[model samples]
Target: MTFTAMVAQPPPMPDDPGGRGEDFGKSSPVGLLVLLVFLVAVVFLARSMTKHLRRVPASFDPPAGKHEAPEKEVAPVEKPEEQKNGAS
Candidate 1:
């Protein structure tokens, strides 16, 4: 009787197949530029938003006693004599 051990092994990595492995898992220059552009845009947007937020009034309610000119004082108009008498 004889006993044998069978072991499974993972495939080996290629040193450089068709120059594909050299730059594998590496970021490209274009990718870095795009990321930088996005970061810049985010910074500008944040600055703009902060400025606008600061300009906003703390409370939407107008300041006390600062509303429209005191409502004009208008005399009530008199009704027509016929309408007052009563129309049919």
Candidate 2:
């Protein structure tokens, strides 16, 4: 058979029943409620994390006490003088 004869025409599309059936992509109430719950949880967690983070210190050192003495610096050791040419 010729290519043109072998090719069959597609069936006609159904008539457009515009605005007849329920909308295809409408968001249900349950889905909206779930989304709202998720958003609220995110906001609550963010606020809570911010509150906790504000109490954290940048450095790990403990705060100094009023009665605590300051640390002392160590002095370097002096090297003994070398004896010249086997002289004791």
Candidate 3:
């Protein structure tokens, strides 16, 4: 009458070939073909990624210290003499 007694009972075995349940939980050839296709795609993708990674340059920045940048020159501004005299 208790749950333990119910659970202790062994599960019934599936009926022999006379029943339609014989093929239950079984995979077909189409499933195997799909799995193989996905595996092949993954392999090809991995190879392509490897090839692209190899083509990539290690550093995007230009070579350091190869070319020195020219120094900028600043010009001083001079006010007109008329404006300077008017302000004074």
Using TM-score as the yardstick, the better of models 2 and 3 is 3
Q: Compare the candidates by TM-score and give the number of the best one.
A: 1
What TM-score would you give candidate 2 relative to the actual structure?
A: 0.42
Q: Which stretches of candidate 3 lie over 4 Å from their true place?
A: 1-24, 66-88
Question: Which regions of candidate 2 deviate over 4 angstroms?
Answer: 1-23, 61-88
TM-score of candidate 3 relative to the true fold: 0.47
Worst 10 residues of 1 by lDDT: 13-22
The window of 10 residues in a row where model 3 has the poorest summed lDDT is 1-10
Model 2 Cα lDDT, one tens digit per residue, 1-88: 6555466796664687565445657879999999999999999999999999999999876576645667999997554554443366
Question: What is the C-alpha local distance difference test score of each model?
Answer: 0.86, 0.78, 0.84
- Model 2 clashing-pair count: 0
- Higher-TM-score candidate among 1 and 2? 1
Q: What's the distance in Å from true for residue 72, model 2?
A: 20
Query: Each candidate's TM vs. the true structure?
Result: 0.48, 0.42, 0.47
List the lowest-lDDT window of 10 residues for candidate 2. 77-86
